[model samples]
Every structure is written in C-alpha cells, then in structure tokens.
Target chain A: MKNWLSPRSTAGIVLIAAALVALPFVLATGGQAWVRIANFAILYVFLALGLNIVVGFAGLLDLGYIAFYAVGAYAWALLASPHFGIHWPVWAILPLGAGLACIAGVLLGSPTLKLRGDYLAIVTLGFGEIVRIFMNNLNAPVNITNGPQGITLIDPVSIAGFRFSGSSEILGVTLSGPQKYYFLLVALAILVIIVNLRLQHSRIGRAWQAIREDEIAAKAVGIDTRNLKLLAFAMGASFGGIAGGIFAAMQGFVSPESFSLIESIMILAMVVLGGMGHIPGVILGAVLLSILPEALRYGVAPVQKLLFGQILVDPESLRMLIFGLALVLVMRFKPAGLWPSPERKRELQPEKAGG
Target chain B: MAETLLAATAVAKHFGGVKALRDVSLTIRSGEVYGLIGPNGAGKTTFFNCLTGLYVPDGGGFEFAGAPLVADAPQQAAARGIARTFQNIRLFGNMTALENVMVGRHVRTRAGVIGAMLQTAATRAEEAAIRQKAIDLLHYVRIEDRADDLARNLSYGDQRRLEIARALATEPKLLCLDEPAAGMNATETEALRDLIDGIRRDGTTVLLIEHDVKLVMGLCDRVAVLDYGALVIEDVPAVVQKDPRVIEAYLGA
Candidate 1:
C-alpha cells in the first residue's frame, strides 16, 4: 500500500515528517518562536507546488493567482467566522473554497488563454489588481467586507465536537498555535508534491508540457491546447484556494493585505528557483524562499544592531533584493532551474549523464 | 478499382481574388508512394495543406478510407490517421528526440488531466509502454542513440529522419511528407529512400511532396504529378517519364 505513494519519495516524506513532528517539541524547548516560521514556510511550499503546474508545466504565467487565494480565504472567512453568523464545517468549506476558486480560474482563463506569453502575464497581473481593488471597494451601498477594514474573529476548525480553539489540549499536546499548523501544512505540501509528480508522468501532464513546449506541434498531434490551458489554470488555482482556506483558519482573520501582487511574484520565484517541472524542486524552492527572509531577519537584525545600534536591513527590503538577484543569476547560470527536470538534465549533459 | 485512401474531388481554393487551386481532383492509393510535384508558385504546398486540413478548401470535399475526410481542421485530419511533416522542421526544439516522438503518441493515450496528476496506475502503465514505443520508433529510424538529444542540436539529415520518426510515432495509416529530401547529400538520400521503402513495407501508405526530380523518379512506384494546382498525370514512374506533360511542366521541354 505504501509503495503506491512513490518508491523512494513516500519513504523520504514519511521519515522527514516524522522527524519534523518530533523536532518542534525539541525546538520548543529552546525558541518556541521558530515554530511559526516553520509553519508558514510549509504553507508556502503548498502554494509553490501548485503554481509550478501552471507556470512550469503548462508555461502560462499567472500574475492574478493570488486572487484565488483571496477567494479561498474569503470563502472560509465568510463561512466559519461569526461575521456572517454561519459556521460551516471545515470539510465542506475546503471543497467549496476550491470549487469557487476553480470557477474563478476558468472565468479568468477561458478568454485570456488566447493571448500568449507576455501579454497573458500582463492580463493576469491586471486581474490580480482588479480582484483586490474590487474586494477593497465592495462597500458601495451595503457593506460586505467592511471596506478594507477586513473580516476578523474567524473560528478555528473543529473535528467531531473537538473545537481546535486556541485552548484545546490533547495527549499532553495542543492542536492549536504554530506547531499543529506546521504538521498540517507539511501533510498538505506532501499531498501537493505527490499529485504534481504523478501528473508529470501521466498523459495529460505530457500534453500540458507539450503545449508549453510547442503549441503548434501539440496542435498538429491532435491535442486541444485551449482546453488543456484552462485545466492548468483551474487546477493550479484550486491549490491556491486550499492554501488560502487553511491560512484563514490558522490566522483567525482575513485581510486584503494578506493577498497581494508580491505574493504572486514570490510564488512564481519559488517554482522557477526550485526548478520548474520538478515537484521536489518547487517544494524546496517554497521552503527556501519563505524561510530565507525569517532566518535572515534573525541574523541581519543582530548584525545591524551591533554596527549601528538599530535595525537597518529588515526582512522585507532584503527579500526584494535577494529575489531580484536570484532570478537573474539563476536564469543565467542555470536556465532550466536549480533542480531542473530530469528530461532537461539529460538534454543538457547528454554524453555524461543520459546513458 | 479501389475507392482510394485519399480522394480530393473537384477541390477548389481561393484567397480573395486569386485562385490558388481550381477544381483539383486526385485519388491516392494504399501501399504506394503518391508524389505531388510542381514548380514554385504552382500551389503544390497549398494543395498539400488543403489535403491535411491546414487550409479549408473554399469548394469541394475529400474522402479518405471510404469515409468523409473534411478539409475543416488539422485535428480532424490527424484523428483520421493523416499525419504530416512540415516543409520547415517544426519539432519541439527544446524537447528531446524521445519527447518529440512521445508527443506524437499523445492522441493514442486517453488519460485526462486528473487521471494524469493522480497517475491512477493505468496512466503509469500506459506511460511506460508508450515511452518504450517512442524509443523503439527512434531506433527503427536509426537515431536511438540520440534519443535524449534536443531536436535543434541534430544534423540536418538526422533532423529529417527524426521528424519522420516523430510522425511515425502517431501511428499514421497514411504519412504525408513535404520535401523529405530537400537538403540531403547522396548518401542521406539513399538512406531516406531505403527508409521510405521500409515504411511502406510496414503497411503505411505514403504521400510524398518533393522538389528533387531524380529522387522522386527513383522512389515513387506510381507518381501523381501536380502542376499549376492541378493533377497533371497519374502513372507509373517509367510511363510518367515518357509523358509529354510531366516533362513540359517540370523539365521545361
């Protein structure tokens, strides 16, 4: 049964997850604050893996992807939070959020898919802005989102009379705070990776890559390129939705600032930096990018404090510099990506490796 | 008489005021190489495009394998086992020789996006088998050693052969080759002739569009000569050599 997950990947993920679950307990002994960073990093991993399918495999650059995340967060926020006075189960909200995001995905992709490459990118960028502005200005006549004030006091998920409120203790362990979120996000990341890997080896996956590689050749071979692009858009958005729903429940709040254009760029960076078309690369990219800022935040603030007696380089400023440099250097040195696809690696070093 | 694998009956095509092909009609037979030969501005490529549904004919219908083969779209032509190579090589440049072939095998596999993402056991089994089949086609075309090479990196002769391999991976009942011997040396041309002969031996009917008169005359068993967007003659190679119209159109007699 375990063999089905992936030969070595299943074993690696299980061992890693088990180690991680035991780790925070060990790390909590020293700095409990590190657990929050860990949790959010895993969350980023899930988002990265999903976005990889669109930009990496399908070769469709999506700048408005964060809108799906917003949709998912809002879906959960409107449902579980007392702002609406409606408490839907987590199980129900997850699918509902994904489905809503998928619908939004199809709506966005159906028309814009005809536009290729850079034009498509610009359109999606506009879309992300449009969604954010729409959400921000929805307080025209009747107030819905409270006009940029945002929704708050979202309830935590509960399973079978077990409200995972910030106060529940189980088996001498709590299911709230950053620790539980870390474990849950890791599981979600693994799920996303498995799905991506499986898709890469499957026929539809090949078709998407084919369409990505050469639209004319793919069309000549009888693939309906339009429908395939739409599928990538919707499926990729569904992951963003799932991640957003999880974010809403974990934060116990929903705000416009959380889903921004920068968030979309950050996710794209993860897919490219990690190596497009490689699931492990995307996950690694997600973790590296998400954790880099915080780890540097801890390291840089101290150095700045020692030199100038004040914090000079903050995490936000450093992230932008590093992100820009990384894109340029990475694309130049390794155009395929850090962890390039097996197919790409073979093509790159035919005499040395492909045999 | 056979109804023919490909029949373009009273086919007419026009772009605005100019007529590209007027009332072009021809019947293509199975187990033989049918040549469409014409000088520049003679609409040979245009006629080939019409046959493959690249350009929808303004007038007339086509019949292939005793069923209606409408000149509506490329996908329709592909679905009916009509596979073609372009005049300019259009293989996925970044993709490996093997992947170029695998894309050709795509229509045969019916796995959907979700089924692919999940790898539903069936997709896995199908992937392995098809991958092997692509490798086999490369081997058959004498380029198995370069299966992992990027298509653009190949020598011109090998690129043409690789294109053929990719088209063959589609499992076409009838293969349409446009200028298969356009830029090849004597040795490569002979190898291509052997390869085309072998492809016919494997039971695939070939429709060849070539500019090389010697290669065309040597390879084709029965030639369908196209001149000025019309079928000039349909005869055995020797008979066509003796025909005045074939000589007048191409050799400038």
Candidate 2:
C-alpha cells in the first residue's frame, strides 16, 4: 500500500482533491458562472475520456458518439421528467440510461465492424445525424422524444432522500444546485479515471492496442477483435450515458439541439488535442477545450474593442478562428498531441528507424 | 510410429480463377520437424493461412490429435494449440519484444476485463506467469537481452527468432514457422535449425515453410515439395532430392 501511494503521488493527490473540493467555495464570489463553466468542463472530461476508449484504444473512428449521449439524456428525461409521467428515482434511471446507450453503441458498432477508418467515421456520423433527426421528428408520430420543443421538467438527482438538485446546508455551508452537482460530477469523474487506468493495463487493453497496430496479427494471436470492438463501443457509450444523465438532472431539460454534430466533433477534438490514448492527456484536453471557449467568450470582446476601436469579429467567431488555428498549430508541431502516451509518441514518430 | 498430431486432407483454396492451394494433403506426426518447401507462388504461405484460419480452405478438413478440427479463425486455431509465424514477419511493431511474446501468450492466459480491472489475485498471478514465460521464451530464442526493445528495433535475425519465441509462447502443440530462416545468413540459418530441433525435442511438432533448400534438406526429417499449388512429392530429403518429379518441378520439365 505504501509503495502504491508513494509520498510524492500521495501529496499530489491530496493537493488536487483539496483544490477541487474548495473550488466551488472559492468561485462563490465570482457567482455561478465560473462554477457552471467548471461543471461543463468536467462533463466534457467524461465525454473525451469515454471517446478515448473507442478512437484511441480500440482505434475505431466514431463520429456519431453524440447519438449515445442523446440516448442517455433522453433515457433519463423520459423516465424521470414530466413528459413521461414516470418520475423514477435519479439513481434508478441513470444506470438504465447508460445501459440504453450501451445497446445503442453495440447496435451502431455491429454493422460497421467490417468497415475501417474513414468509412467507419462516415457511418457513425450518419448514425449521429439519424438519431438527431429521429429526436427532432418523433413528436408527431408518437411524441416519444417530444420533438424540437424537447423534454422539460426533468427531476433532480436524489440519493438516499438527499436531493442534489435543491440547495442544502452542509456543516453550516449552503451549497447551490450546481455546486452540489459539481461534487457528484467530480466523484463520477474520479471513478471514470480509475476505471480507465485499470483498463489501460489490462489484457483487453493490450489486445485493443495490438488490434490498432495490426488487426491480422491480433487475430493470429487469438484476440476476438469483433467482440472487443463492440465492448469498446458499449463501454465508451456507457460513460457518455452517465454524463448525459447528469446533464439532464442538473439542467432539467433535454433537446435534440444539444446533441448535434458539432457537439460530437467538439468531443472528438478534445480527445485528439489532449493526447489520444492517455487518460490524463484526454482530461486535460477536455478541460482546456471546454474552458478555453468560455475564456475566449469573455476576453475576445474586450480585446477586440480595445485593439480595433470597434467590434471586428464577435467573440464566438474569434473563438472558432483561434480554435481552428490552435488545432492546426498543434497538428503541425506536436501531432502526437499535448501529452502523448509513450506508445502513441513512438507510433507517431515522423520516421521510424526500421522503415 | 508416433501418433499423427496434425492430419490435413486434400485442402484447397482459390481466389477467383486462380487456385492458391489445391489438393494439398499432409500429416504431421507428434514431435517431428515437418518441412513444406516450394518455389515462389507455390502456395506455401497460403497453406499456412488456411491452417491458421486467415483463409478458409475451399475443401478438406483437419484432424488434430485424432479430433476433427473445427476452428475457423486464427484466434481459434491458436487457442486449439496451433501457433504460427508469418513469412513477412508480423510482429506487433510498436510493442516491446517481451510484449509481443506476451500477446502470443494470449490464448494461454485467461484474465478477462473484470479481472483485469480489479487486478484480482488470479489476474495478477496469471499476468506475472505470462511475463515470466515470455521472458523464458525470449531466453530460449537467445534474445532475452533485447526483450525490452521494441520488436521493430531488433536486428533482422533477432526479429525472426523473436517471431519463433512469440509462437512458442502459445504453448502450441504444433508450431508452424513460415520462412523462419528467411533473410538470415548461413550462420543464422544453422542456428534456426538447432532451434527447431530443440522445439521438437521439447514435444512440439514443428511444421515449417522454407524457401532455403539447403536448410530444409539439412534440417527436415521428411520434406514435402509443392509446385503450382500442388504437392509434387513427400519423402525423406535424400529421396526427395533424387525424385524425377521433384527435379522436374524445380527445373521445369
């Protein structure tokens, strides 16, 4: 136990945990805006880390990942919200949402198992669009998704009679809804990190890496690549589902617009920009990409007003331009990503010595 | 006579109009070094692919240890105790030499996702055992010092031997080596012959596809000659060398 928790790592863990635990209180003066942004950043970390399993570990390109997110959110909303009239407990529906998302993942993964690379990407992209369109049009036929108007009045998360959506005083400290959700999200994210780390060192993880390197060789060594790929898809989708459940409970709303193609691309970007297979790198990517836009949202307008004496480009537009430029620069300078795993670093080496 | 460990009967494969393998039948006795030799495009590699289930044979079936073989994928074949190397060397290039052999130990190891995630006692013990076995295999191949290096970084001879070490990690009853001495110097070829001898002595049947005539003639107890997707002759190396059909198949009668 002592060896596992070396002093330096123990110190680092304590420092990080304390900082995270104190963040909501520290941002109290800044209002809920900062806390909400942090919430979203952590949410994206869930998304990017989940996607790393498929794209980074399994080496499957899935552009329809947002479809799973939508499935999860809707699963939570339809079960716990006013639209469905079910009012299931948040805990009960969360796992169901994740399971539904896993099924969706497997369904999407099966047909595309034979497709490689870009073809797989296109199919997943279509699957994502199809889900979004289904959500948009389902109201007329069955009112299943409540269509474009979206599902509203989703129930807040409650565990053992303690409501997370409503404010409560803990040790004389009043916690707001977002702050409470923030703690829960942090716990969930930590769980994800642990799971991801364990998986990366496992036999399945090694087989996935071998498949990524050479499918034929992986098969030769007796790895069931087809089932493993589906497992990757399902596992990754489950995390997306959990995040979506949290998103629905916190926001009390779900809509087709929230699960758009751009959201999927943004999640993929987070995975690629951070460092594809590395867990820490993916979290870093997710946090940076999530918060950077908000930072740009506030900084760009003022900078533009000061530099140009007029609004040359809106902050949103500037954010896109800078984001594109950053991706390009990163690709050119550090294709392995900001914090590439040693394996990924070797894989992306410009010129391998052996040819 | 030793029991026939592997008996492939009239195996056939074709690609559109081109027959890659046709009517190829051979039996490998337990604990014997069996050689499959042929010219370019003689379907030696294709035959290996069929046995390993990379390609489904159009006809014929196999019996291993008197049990009808039903494996239809490489993984299944490996699981059933038949491991193979590639003619072009298909080592997982990015993985370390030890890791490559560890992957070869996949069929023998049984730590699934849950066990791996929890790092249970069984999983840990299995993984440690696999690592030790891989290291031992590397040592057997005389490349234990290069075990930590990436497979692609190893020298050509070491890489070829590494492939053998990897195949041996499956604890296979029968090891199929595709041109194990390919691109090796005469000295390296001699070393590979000794290695095959050692493998057979260790109770594994050795089935090899080699283009090196001298190495095959020197090392094989019995050799099978393939020409134009068909087996022309199978006999002792001395008898095979003198056969008119073998001579004609090699020199084009």
Candidate 3:
C-alpha cells in the first residue's frame, strides 16, 4: 500500500494538490479570483490530457477534439437545465456526457481509420468545424440550443436533494462560485490521470506505441491497428466530454463560439508544450495555457501601468503573444514535449535517423 | 522437443499480378538454427513478411508451436513469444538504448502506464526487474555500455546488437534474424556468429536469412535453400554445399 505511492509521483501529486487547495485560501483577499483561474486551468488540463491520449499516445492528430467538448457541454446543459425540466445531477450528467462523447469520437474516427497520419488530422479538423457550425445552425423551429444565442440560465448541481446553488453551505463547507467548480475539476483531473495511466500501461498502450513507432512492425506482430486506433480516439474523446459537462455547469451557459477551432489548437498546443504521452506534462500544459491567460487578464494591466508608464499591452494580446512564442520556443527546443514517454522514446530511437 | 518451433506449410503470397511467394514450406526445430538462403527476387523477405503477418499470406498455412496461424500482426506475434529483427535496423532513433530495449519488454511487462508513471511498488519492482533484464540482454548482445546512449548514435555493429537485445526483450521462444550480418565486417560477422551460438545455447530457436553463404553454412544447423520461393534443398551445411539443385539454382544451370 505504501509502496504504490512512489515518493516522486506521490510527492508531485501531493505538492500540486496542496498548492491548488491552498491557493484559494492564500489568494482569498482578492475576491477569490485565482480560484476561478485555477478552475479554468484545471478544466483545460482535463481537455489537454484527453487530447494527449488521442494525439500523443495513440499518435492520431485530432484537430476536431473540440466537437466532443461541445457535445459534453451541450449534453450537460440540456440535462441539468429546464430545457427538458429533468434537472439531472452533475454526477449523472458527467457519465452521460462522457458516453455521448465516446460515441461522437467513434462517429468521427470510424470512417477515417484507413486514412492514416496527417489525413486523419485534416479530417478531424473539418469535423470540429462541422460540429461547431451544426450547433450554430441546428436551432431552427424547435429551439434546441436557443440558436446562436445558446442555452442560458442552466441549473447548478443537486445531489440527493442537496442542491449546490446560490451560496449553499453543506457539512459546514461554504460552497460558492468557483469552489465546486474547482473541486469538480480537481476530481476530473485525478480521474483522467488515473485512467490515462492505466490505458498507457495496458496491452493497448503498447499496441498504440508500436503503431506510432512502426506501423508495419506493429502489424507484423499481429496487433489490430485499426481497432486499437479507434479505441484510443473514443477513449480520449470521453475525457473531453466529461470536461465539457463541467464547463457547462460552471458557467451555466452553452455557446457555439466557446468550442471553436482556436480552442482545439489551444488544447493541442497544451498537450505538445507539456510533452506527448507524458501525463504530468499534459496536466501541466493544460493548467498553463488555460490559467495563464486568465491570470494575465487582470494582472497584466496593472503591471504594464507600473512598469512601462504607458500601456503597451492588453491581457488578451499579451497572453496570445506569450503562448504563441512559448509554442514556437517549445517546438524549436523541446520538440518531444516537456516530459516525454521514456518507453516510447526508446522504442523509436533504434531506427529513426538518429537512433 | 515440440516437433518444430515454427512451421510454414505451402505458403503463397501475391502482389497484384506478381507472385511474391509460391507454395513455400519449411520446418524450424527447437534450438536449431535454420538458414533461409536465396538470391534477390527469390522471395526471401516476402516469405518473412508472410510469416510475421506483415503481409498476410493469400493461401496455405503457417504454424507456430503446433498452433495454427492466422493473419497475426507483429505485436500479436511478439505477444505470442515470436520476435524478429528487421532487414534495415528499425530502432526508435530518438530514444536512448535502454529505452529501446525497454519497449521490447513492453508486451512482456504486465505493468500498465499508470504503474510506470506512479512508480507503484508492483510497477516499480517489475520495472526494475525489466531494467535489469534489459541490461542483461544488452550484455548478451554485447552492447551493455551503450544502454544510455541514443540508439541513433550507435555504430553499425552496435545498432545490430541493439536490435538483437530488443528482440530478446520480448522474451521470445523463437528469434528470427533478417540478415543479421547484412552490413558487417568479418570481425562483426564473427561476433554475430558467437552471439547466435550463445542465443541457441540459451535455448532459443533461431531462423535466419543470410546472403553470405559462408556465414550461413558456418552458422546454420540446417540450411533451407530457396529458389524463386520454392525450397530447392534442405540439409546440413556440407550436404547443401554438395547438392546439385541448390548449386544449379544459384549458378543459373
């Protein structure tokens, strides 16, 4: 039991969790703004982590990952809100969103299985645009998503008649804005970490890496390359779905603009910047991209006024510039990612030009 | 001990109008090194492709350890205790030597990615044991010191040796070498001979394809000469050397 917690990983989890948990308390003076940023960042970590499975571990570049995210958010909104008047709980919506996302993943990945490599990426990118446009255009006569304006005033989660909404205190804990969101995001991040770890270590993981390293070699060994790739795609998409569900609940709104192609690129950049197939790196990548912009939003203005005398940068522009430069620098230097999969790195080195 | 470690019976493969393999059949026994020797266009590599399930055979059957074979892919073959080195050393170049070997053990290792990431006791113990095994394998293939170096940095001989180690990482019962001595100096070839003998001594059944007749003859317990995808002769080195059919096929009658 004790040994399962390898000091390094255990310590890492402990440190990160402690830091995240303590951040809200430490930064409590400023209207709990950092917690909101943390929530946003953690949610993104989940998205990036999911994409890492599809893009990094499975070696399938998915530019349409945001579609699943949208699916999840919409699914959550429709279920939790008065849209249907069912008012499903967050726990219930989470799995439902994930299941829908998995199905969506299969739908997107199925026909493209035979395409291979960059072709799959382009197809997925098209799929993302398709999903967003579909959401935008789908609300004609019935008003399913409230059209381009999106479904608003979604209900907060209720568990066993215990509702977490409009500042409720449960078990002596004051649950308010970004608090439940942060908790939910943390839980999801942990779950993703665990699941991705399991997937990578299992027989399936080896098959994925084999395909990545050498498709011919993998086939020669009797691996079902097509099915395995599909499984990876679906599995990765499910995580995106879960994150989307939480996103809907946190904001109490759903909009087509939210899940754009830029969102997909941002997620991809997060995965790449952190390191492909490295869970910790993926997590880090997510938190950085998602939270960094939010932090810069409020902080950058004051810093600019203080340091430069004249305001030279806004939060959005500076954030974008920094992230873009970070991506460029990462690609220039650490192409394999921040923390690469050691075993994967090994399997390919023997024959690839340098190996 | 088990009749033969591997057996391909009347195997046939075709690419478009051209026939790559034409009803080729051969038996490979335990601890015995069977050499597949043939000239270009004789379908030597095609036979390998068929056997390993890279190119599924169009007709006929191949069996491993008395089990009927299917279009079993390479990773499946690796799982089923069959390992092979490629003709052109296909190592993961960006990875270090140790990592390359570790990947070979990937199928053999039961620990999942989580276990590796978390460094769980079960995973850690298993990983350590595997690391040791990889080290031993490197030592066996005579590339122990190069374990930390990137695979791309290895010399030709060391790269070949690393491939051997990677194959051994699968803990394979039957090891196939596709031109193990392909681009080697005589000394390296001699070293490979020792390595093959060592592997055989350690109880692995080896099936090798070689262009160098002398190396094939010197190393093989039995030689199966292929002429245009047909087994022209199967005998000991001396007997194969004396066979008129094999000579005629090679000498063009």
What DockQ, on C-alphas, does every prediction get? 0.48, 0.67, 0.25
List the candidate 3 regions with Cα displacement exceeding 4 Å: A1-18, A26-28, A32-34, A140-146, A160-162, A169-175, A194-207, A221-224, A299-326, A333-355, B1-5, B79-81, B96-98, B106-136, B171-173, B248-253
Q: Look at candidate 2 and tell me the lDDT of residue B43.
A: 93
Query: What class would a CAPRI assessor give candidate 1's docking?
Result: acceptable
Task: Give the per-residue lDDT of model 2 (tens digit) for B113-194.
Answer: 7897788999888888988999999999999999888888788889889888988888889999999888888898889899
TM-score of chain A of 3: 0.91
**TM-score of candidate 2 on Cα atoms, chains taken together:** 0.97
lDDT of each: 0.82, 0.88, 0.80
- Per-residue CA lDDT of model 1 for B1-253, tens digit only, reads 5337888898888889878787888888887887778887677778878878778898887898989876656766777888888888777766778888888888777778666666678877788888999999999999999987787778888889888998888788889999998888889899999999899999999999998888888888778777777778888889988889978998678
Candidate 3 lDDT score at position B65:
84
Docking class of 3: acceptable
Pairs in clash, predicted candidate 2: A222-B75
Interface RMSD of each: 4.6, 1.8, 5.3
Q: Which 10 consecutive residues of model 3 chain B have the lowest summed lDDT?
A: B111-120
- Specify the highest-lDDT model's number: 2
Candidate 2 chain B minimal-lDDT segment of 10 residues: B64-73
Which interface RMSD does candidate 1 score?
4.6
**Model 3 over residues A1-355: C-alpha lDDT tens digits?**
3565898878887897798777765655567666777778888888888898888887898999999999999999888787768687777888999999999999998899877778988999999999999889888877777668988878765667755455667689676667766776777788787778766754556568767777765554445677778888888889889888888877888999999999999999888888888887888788777877877787899898999887897688888788888888887777777666674445434454432
Ranking by TM-score: 2, 1, 3
Candidate 2 lDDT at B81 equals 87
Give the per-residue lDDT digits (tens) of candidate 3, residues B143-200: 8888888777789889899988888888888888999898898999999999999999
